[model samples]
Structures are given as C-alpha cells and as structure tokens.
Target: MPRSVLVTGGTSGIGRAVAERFTADGAGVVITGRREHLVESVAKELGAVGVVCDAADPRAVEALAARFDTLDVLVNAAGGLGAAQPGPEAAELEAVLAHWRADLDGNLLSAVLTTTALKPVLAPGGTALAVGTIGSERRGGSYGAAKAALAAWYAMLSAELGPRGVTANVIAPGYIAGTGFFQGAMTDVREQALIAETHTKRAGTPRDIAETVFFLASAGARHITGQTIHVDGGAFTTR
Candidate 1:
C-alpha cells in the first residue's frame, strides 16, 4: 500500500515542492490551502487530492482531518511573513498587534493546530516535519519569533509523540530562490549579499528543502527525532 502524506500550504513554494516530491515517489498525497481555487488547481496539476482549509483555523483543520483517516507523513509548510499595512497606518499600534498575531497564527499556531487535530490519525513510524526559518536564529521580527516558538513547541511535541513511533522535527531554510517568498521585493544588491553569505555562493532552492524532508522521513531517519535540521547552503551554521 502507498504511504499517505498530507502537506499544508501546498498551493505554492516549498509546500508545493514537497507535495510534488511525495507524489512522484508514489505516495497518496493530499495538499491543503486556504484558497479553494488554488488548491483545486494544484491538486489537479499534481494528481493529488486538494483540500480547502486554513490550518490555523481549528474548525477548518477539523474538517480537513475528516477527509483522511490514516497518515504516514505530515508536512507543515504553511508560513510566511505577515502582510504590512499600506501607508502611515502601518505604524499604528493596531497594525503592529495584527501583524504579530498574524505571524503567530500563520506560522506557529497553524502547525500546532493541524498536527494536534491529526495526531490520532498518524500511523506508527510516521514523521511530522515543520518548515522553519533561519531568521529565527538571528532576526527578531514577528515571523522569526513565531518560528522560534515553533521549534520550541516541536521539542515538546516530540516528547509526547515519540513513544507512539512518530518522529517530530523542524527544517529551517535560508535565502531560497525560485519561490514567491520575496514576491518581487528583492533587489539585485540584496540578492547578491544573501548569496555571498552562503559558503555555497548560491541561493537554496525549494527542491533542496524538499529533498531533506524526504530523507528525514525515510526509514533511515527513524532514529532521528526532536531535531531541527538546517537546509541553508551554509548561510547559517552551528558552532
């Protein structure tokens, strides 16, 4: 029987890449996103099931869980920087609060809620991987804070699920290219500087992260749990 894989935020970027990888490997894959149209389109394109769901929304996640009963892999790839308000209103206290909450909800809470809701359906020897960011290690912005908390939460989660034969881990990426992450906000100078920081002298790719995710979930990685694997091209290194 084919393994079942669920990837949230699979409409684009890293999520989409991960979903594609699993589908190509002959897994029964399901991808979810907040937009119904994008979800449907991508699912059709990849020949995987697409679910319309907001992972941060408990009710929506609950409904998403109803669509599947058994899962061998769960990839939490739904996260991004919160939107900045336009004009002077961006500096308002309300705007700051909204941004912070949005980061928490989108990056941190989304993974927690979705994983919690689907915990029971996860099979033994399964793996749950959450996409994190190198920003959390140095940059102290709202998104970074949320991702930092996400790593911390995963530690506790690993302890809870380890005995059940599920492995929980985080994969943090830095300066990845070929993604809408920058959304046209990147400049030539900024891109050059980012690449220079990496020892590889090249930007990372969505497939880079996707490949690491595949390896971590493989049988060879069954002994690996409660770890945060950095997938950057030497941009951020541990001492």
Candidate 2:
C-alpha cells in the first residue's frame, strides 16, 4: 500500500501544493481545512480525502485523530495571520487580547493539539512537519511569535518521538508569493522590496516550500529532526 499522508490546511497555499506533490507520488492523501466547500473542492481536484476540521479545537483534533488508523506523515500546514481586528471602538485591551489569542490559537495551538492527538497513531519511521515563517525571527509580532514558539515546541517533540523512529521538524519559508497570504495588501513596491531581500532576487513559491517538505519526509532525511530548515533563498542565512 502507498504511504498514508495527512496535511492540515490543505485547501490552498503551501498545504495544497504539498498535497499535490504527494498525490503525484502516489501516496494516499487526506487533507483538512476549516471550510467544507473548499475542502470538498480541493479533495476532488487532488483525488484525496477531505476533512473539515478546526485544528485549534481540542475536541475537534481528537475527533480527527480517531478517523485515522495509522499515518505515515503528518504535515501541520494550517496556520496564518489572524483576521484583522475591528476598529478603535472595540474595547482597546479586549480587542488586543482577542487578537493575540486568535493568532496563538491558529498558529501555535492548532499544531500542538493536532500533533498530540495523532501522536499515538503515527507510524514508526514516519515524520511530522510544521510550516513556519521567517517572521518568527524578526518583526512578526504575534504571528511570528506563535511560529517561534512552534519551533521551540517541535524541538522537544523530536526528542520524545525519536525513539519511536519518528522525526519532527519545521520548514520556515520567506516571502512566498501566490498564496493570498497578504490578503490583497501586497503592493508592487512592497513585493520588490521583499524580493530584493533575497539573494535569489525573486519571491519564493509554494512549490519551493512543498519541495522542501517532501524532501524532509523522505528516507534521506531520516536522520534529521528537531531542527528548523530555512527555505528562503538566502534571505535569512544561518551562520
């Protein structure tokens, strides 16, 4: 049988690209998203299973885990910047707190809850990967901080799962385009600025991150774990 793979937030963006790559490789793929219609549509497009799930909800994560018998790979790709907050009249401190909580729940707790619930059924020799962002290292604010915490958490997760022949890692991408991540706020000048920051002199693509994700889950990467791999085209070079 082909390897079974689950990718959360797989309706679009990097998650969808990852699912497509695996599907092309003939793996049995299951994808989850918060929107039912998009999940259904993407599932049909990719010929993979579709699940509607809110990964941040503990109960929902548990329910999702119960649907799987065993998983060969788990990709936690279900996170993004929280929705924009309301205007000034929305209670200053309350609005700020809610915004932070939403970001933390979406970007951090979602991965934590889903991974923990599925830990028992992760096949030996499998891999668990989370999608992180370059913002984690700098001026990302709450969204970046959530990803930073995710990287920290995954390091410990690798140690715990290593003996079971499982590996865990984070893939941090910088300025990937065509993901609608900017919510239509991207300007020509801003895009050029982002591109200039990269040694490649171009923005990254979903395929760029997808390819990295595929490699990390492959046999060649079995020895790598508890690490954050940057796929930013020298934008965030590590010394």
Candidate 3:
C-alpha cells in the first residue's frame, strides 16, 4: 500500500510542492489549509484529500488528527512571517507581545501541537518534517527565533520518537523564489544580493525543498533523524 501522508498548509508554496510530489508518487496524501475554497480546489486538482484547518489551533489540529488512523509521514509547513510590526520605539508593549506571540504560535506551536496530537497515529518508520528557514541562523528577528526554537524542540522530539521508529527533522530553505515569501517586497538589488550569497548563483525553488523532503521520507534515509537539513544551495554552509 502507498504511504499515508499529511501536509499542513499544503495549499501553496513549499507545502503545495511537497504535497504534489507525494501525490505524484502515489502516496495517500491529505493536505490542510486555512481557506476552504483553496483547499477544495487544490485537493481536486491533486486528487488528494484536503482539510480546512489552522494547524496552530489546538482544537482544529485535534479534529484533523481524528480523521487519520495511521499516518506514515507528517510535514508541518504551516508557518510564515507574521504581519509587519512597528518598531519597538513606535509600538506599545502589548502590540509587541502580540506580534511575537503570533509568530511563535504560527511557526513553532503549529508543528508542536500537530505532532503531539498525531503522535499516536504515526506508524513505525514514519517521518515528521517541518519547513524552516536559513534566517534562523542569522538576522532573522521574531520569525527566525521561532524557527530556531523549532529545531531545538525537534531534537528532543527525535529522541522521544526514536524508539517508536519515527524520525523528526527540519528542512531549512534559503532565498527561495516564487513562494511569495517576500510578499512582493523584493527588489532587483536585494534579489541579486541574495543570489550572490549562494554558491549556485541561483534562487532555490520549492521543488528543491520538496525533493529533499521526499528523500528524507524514503527507506534509504531511515538512519537519518534529529537534524536540520539546509537546502540553500550553499548560502549557509555547514562545517
């Protein structure tokens, strides 16, 4: 039988690409998104089940978990930068707190809550993956902080899940294009600057990350676990 896979925030960008990859592989894929219409449309297009869910919401995640009896792969791709916030000097303390909280909830808690809720359903030799960013290594602000924390949390999670034969890891991407991640705020100069940082001299694509994810879920990768795999085309090198 094909593997049963679940991808949160799979309606667009890296998440959508991951879902499509699995769908093409004949996996029994289920994708979740916050918008009903988009989820329905994408599900029909990909021939995969689509769920309308906010992965960060505990109740919604629980409901999502209830639908699956056994899951072979879980990909938490439901996070992004929160709305732009005013500078500390301009914004009130309450506003700052709210912004930070939103980032943590969306980026960190979404993975944590979903993993916890579905832990029991994860089958032997299954994999749990999260989409992270290279920003977590450098000048990333609140968003980066959350991603960093996700890696830390997954270290412990991998230890806990190891005996159960489930692996956990994070795939951190750098300067990916066509993800709307920059939200139309990118300039030619900025884009070139980013591309120059990579040894490949090209922007990463959603497909790049998707291929990494696919490999990690394969039997060949069963020995790999509890690590952050950067897919940045050498923008951030590891020693």
Candidate 4:
C-alpha cells in the first residue's frame, strides 16, 4: 500500500514541492495550510488531501491527528518568521523577547505540538521530518534561536520515538530562493552575499529540499534518524 504522508506547510515553496514529490512517488498525501483556499488549491492540484490547520494551536493539531487513519510520514514545514514584537527604544529587549516567543510558537512549538498530537497515529517505522534553517548558526536572531531549540528537542524526541520505529529528522536548508522566505526582506547586498557564500554558487531550490526529504523518508534511510541533513549547496557548511 502507498504510504500516507502529511506536509504541514504544503501550500507553497518547499512544502509544496515535497508534497508533489511524495505524490509522484505514489503516496497518499495530506497538506495543511492556514489558508483554506491555498490549501484546497494545492491539494486539488496535487491530488492530495488538504486540511486547514494551525500547527501552533493544540486543538488544530489534535484534530489533524484525528483526521488521519494512518500516518507514514509527517513533515513539519509550517514554520516561519513572524512579525517582530515591538520593544522599548531604550532596551530593545521587548522586541527581542516577543520575536523569540513567536519563533518558539511558529518554529518550535508548532512542530512539537503537532508531533505530540500525531505521535499515536504515526506508524511504526515511519519518518517525521522537520524543516530547519541554517540561520541558527549564521546571523539568526530569534528565528534562529527557535530553530536551534527545535533541533535540540528533536534529539530527545528521536530517542523516545526510536523504539516505536518512528524516525525524527531535520532538514536544514540554506538560501532557498523564491520561497517567499525573503519575500519582503531581500536586499541586493544580502542576495549577492548569499550567492557568493555557496560552493555551488547558486541559490538552493525547493526541489533540492524535496529530493532530500524523499531520500530521508525512504526505506534505505531507516537507520538515519535524529540527524539534520543540510541541503544548501554547502552554504551552511563551508560558508
């Protein structure tokens, strides 16, 4: 039987690409997005089930778990940078705290809650892939910190889930272009700098991440659990 897969941020970019890849591989996929329209559109287009869910919300995550009959793979790709909270002009501490909290909710807790909810349904010998960022080591601020926390938690989670035959891994991506990741924040200098830092010297694409995820979820990679695979054209490693 084809495996049942879920990509939490399946409406766009890496999540969309990964969902497509799994669908093409003959798996049944369910993609979730906060937006019903986008989720429906992508689900219809890819021939996968679409569920509207907010991973940060415990109720939603539980509902998502209840919706699944059997889960073979769970890809937590719904994380992103939220608006930075305002801070005191004198301290700049509030903004930092707020941003970090949002990041925790968006990047860390979203996956944590969702995974906890779905842990029961996740089949033995399944894979759970969470999307992480290279910024945790780079110039990452609150965003990076939250992702760093996620990586840390996944280690323990992997140990706990291992005996159940469920593998939890992270895919740390570097400089993926056209993902709305830098939709409003991209600057000419930052763009040039990113390009110059890579060994491939080309921006990473969503498909690159999709392929890596595919490989990690494969039967051959069953032993590769609790690891973070970087798919950034050597940007995070060498740069």
Candidate 5:
C-alpha cells in the first residue's frame, strides 16, 4: 500500500521535485500551491492531487486539512525570499519592516500554519520534512531569519509530536543552482563566490534535497527528529 503524503508549494523547484520523488517511490502524493492552473497542471503531469491554497491564510490551511483524513508524510516545501513591502502610504521604517514581515510569512509561517492545520490528521509515527536554508546561519537576508524560526518551530513541534510517532526535521540547503530560486539575482562574481565556499565546488540541486528527504522519511531515520541536516555540498560545514 502506498503511503499518503502532502507536499505544499508543489508546483515549483524543491516542492515540485519532492512531489515527483514521492510519486516515484509509490506514495499517494497530494500537492498544494497558490497558482490554481499550475497546481492543476503539475498534478496532471505527475499523477498527484493538487489543491490551490495560500499557506499564509488560516482558512485556506484549514481547508487544506479537510482534504486529508490521515497523512503519512507532510513536506513543508513552501518557503522563499521575502521582499520589500508594496505600499504608497508606508514610510521608510515601515517599508523595512515589511520586508522582514514578508520574509517571515513566506519562509516561516507557511510551515507553521500548514502543520498546525494538519496535526489532527497526521498519521502516527509519520514523517515530516521542511525545506530550510543555510541563510539561517549565514548571510540569508531576512529570509534566513524566517527559516531560523522554522527550525525552532519544528523543534517545538517535534517535542509535542514525538511521542505520537511523528517526526519533523529541517533540511537546510546551500547554493542550489539552476532553480528560479536565484531568479537571475546572481552576478558572475556572486555565483563563483558561492561555488568557492563549497568543498565539492558544485552547487546543490533540488534532487539532492529530495533524496535526503526520502532518507529522513524512511524507516532508517525513525530515530531522528528535531534536527537540521545541511545539504549544501559541505559549504556550510567547511565554510
């Protein structure tokens, strides 16, 4: 029998790849994304169920939970860089605050809100993995701070859920190349500098994180919880 898994933000990059990986492994995968068309398209392509929901909205999250009765895995792959606020009446300080707020909501609260909504339906001894960034420990913009919050929240959740046989962990990635994650933000020097930091001298890929997630969710990782595993090609450990 295939285990039922839910992956949020499953239309792109890390989330899309994670969804595919689970499907390949014979899991009954359901994915969610904000874009209804893209979500539907990806679902059709991958043979997974896709729901349209914004993770930041409580109602939407609650609705998301209503879709599942029991979940074997919940991968919170819904995070990204926060940007400056958009407003004409906002002042300078408020604009700055907006940037942080955006990041926090995008990178941190998505997981929190989604997980909280799904708590009742999570299968016992289930596995959960959230995508984090090395930025939490280094120069990750305001987005990093949000990811840091995510890690801490997972620790709290793990403490509460551990006895129930549910495991939650974070996978912090570094320098993932070829994803819209960079979105052409990198100058040549910046890209090279990142590559230099990794002992492997190679950028990480979505598949790298996906494979690690597979392991962490497997029986072999049953003993592990409340942990952060770096998937950054030794960039974080060495640099």
Candidate 6:
C-alpha cells in the first residue's frame, strides 16, 4: 500500500509543491486548505483527496482527523502571515493581545492543534514536518516569533514521538521566489539584497523545499529527528 500523507495548507506555494512531490512518489496524499473551492480544485487537479479545514481551529482539526484513519506523514504547512494586526502604537491592551494571538494561531497554534488532534492517527514510524522560516533566526517580529516558537515546540514533540517511532522536524526556508510569500512587500532592491546574501545568489524555489520534505519522510532520514533543516542556500549559516 502507498504511504498515506496529509499536507495542510496544500492549496498553494510550498505546501502545494510538497503535496505534488509526494503524490508523484505514489503516496496516498491528502491536501487541506481553508478555502473549499480551491481545495476541491487543487485536489482534483492533483488527483488527491482534499479537505477544507483551518488547522488552527481545534474543532475543525478534530473533524479533519475523522476523515483519515491512518497517516504515514503529516506536513503542517498551514501557516502564513495574516493581515496586519494592531501595532505597538495601539493603546488598547486587548487589541494588542488579540493581534499577537492571531499570529500564534495562524503560524504556531495551527501546527500544534493539528498535530495534537491527529497524533493518535499517526502510524508508527511516521513523520511529522512543520514549515518554518528564516525570519525566526533573525529579527522576527510577531510572525517570526511564532515560527521560532514552532521550532522550539518541535524539539519537545520530537522527544515524545521519537520513542514511538514518529519523527518531528522543522523546515525553514529563506527568500523563496516562486511563492506568494513576499506578498508584494518585497521591492527590487530588497529582493536583490536577499538574493545576494545567499551563496547560490538566487531565491530558493518551492521544489527545493519540497524535495527536502520528501527526503525527511524517507527511511534515510530516520536517524535525523528533532532538527531544523535550512534550505536557504547558505543565507543563514551556523558555525
């Protein structure tokens, strides 16, 4: 039987690419997106199952879990920068709290809730992959902070899942060009500077990350757990 894989936020960008890679590998892939129509369209186009779900929502995640009885891989790619929330200038404490909460909900909580809800369904020897960002390693604000927290949380998760034969890790990318990640925030000079920082002198592609995800889910990566694999072309290096 083909390995069953679940990719949340698989309708576009990196998530979509990861789903496609697994599908090509003959995995029984299921993709999820918050939007119904897009989920349906992408699923049909990719010849995989699609479910509409907000992975951050506990109830929705529970409902989503009911759709799959067993999963060999779970990719938590259902996170992105949401709308601009109240800035530091905002006076109301409630507004400030809500703003930060939204960031966590979108980026960190979504992965946590989804993983928690589906933890039981994850088969022995399965893998869990969470999408992260280089922003967390640098001057990450709210969104970055959330991604950083995600990486930290994964360490603990790995400790628990490792003995059970399930592996957990985070994939952080830097300045990927093909995705809508920049969201019109990137200018010509800024884009160039980002590219120049990389040893490869080019923005990373979704396929780059997709291939990494595919590798992590393979038997070769069984010894590699609780680690963050940066596919940023040497943009950020560790000594």
User: RMSD per prediction, one decimal?
Assistant: 1.5, 1.1, 1.9, 2.1, 1.5, 1.9
The 10 consecutive residues of candidate 3 with the worst lDDT sum are: 82-91
Model number with the top lDDT = 2
Model 4 lDDT at residue 53: 96
RMSD (Cα, Å) of candidate 3?
A: 1.9
Off by over 4 Å in 5: none
- Assess each prediction's global lDDT (C-alpha) against the native: 0.93, 0.95, 0.94, 0.89, 0.89, 0.92
Please write out the lDDT profile of model 5 over residues 24-76, one tens digit for every residue.
Answer: 99999999999889999999999999999999899999999988889999999
Candidates 4 and 6 compared by TM-score, better number = 6
Judging by TM-score against the true structure, name the best candidate.
Answer: 2
Colliding residue pairs in candidate 1:
none
Better of 2 and 3 by TM-score: 2
**lDDT tens readout by residue for model 3, 1-239:** 99999999999999999999999999999999999999999999999999999988999998999999999999999989886466666658778787898899999999999999999999999999999999999998999999999999999999999999999999999999988787889999999999999999999999999999999999999989999999998999998
Model 6, span 41-119: residue lDDT tens: 9999998999999887888899999888898999999888765467676779867677788889999999999999888
Q: Write the residue-wise lDDT of candidate 1 on 12-111 in tens digits.
A: 9999999999999999999999888999999999999999998889999999988877999999999898765545646678788888998999999999
After superposition of all CA atoms, the RMSD between model 1 and the true structure is 1.5
| Backbone collision tally, model 4 | 1
The Cα RMSD of model 6 versus the native structure comes to 1.9
**Least accurate 10 contiguous residues by lDDT in model 6:** 82-91
Judge candidate 6 against the unseen true structure and give its global Cα lDDT, from 0 to 1.
0.92
Name the regions of candidate 3 deviating beyond 4 angstroms: 84-91
Q: Indicate the worst ten consecutive residues by lDDT in candidate 2.
A: 83-92
For model 2, state the Cα shift of residue 50 in Å: 0.2
lDDT of 4 at 70: 78
Pairing residues by index, what is the TM-score of model 2? 0.98
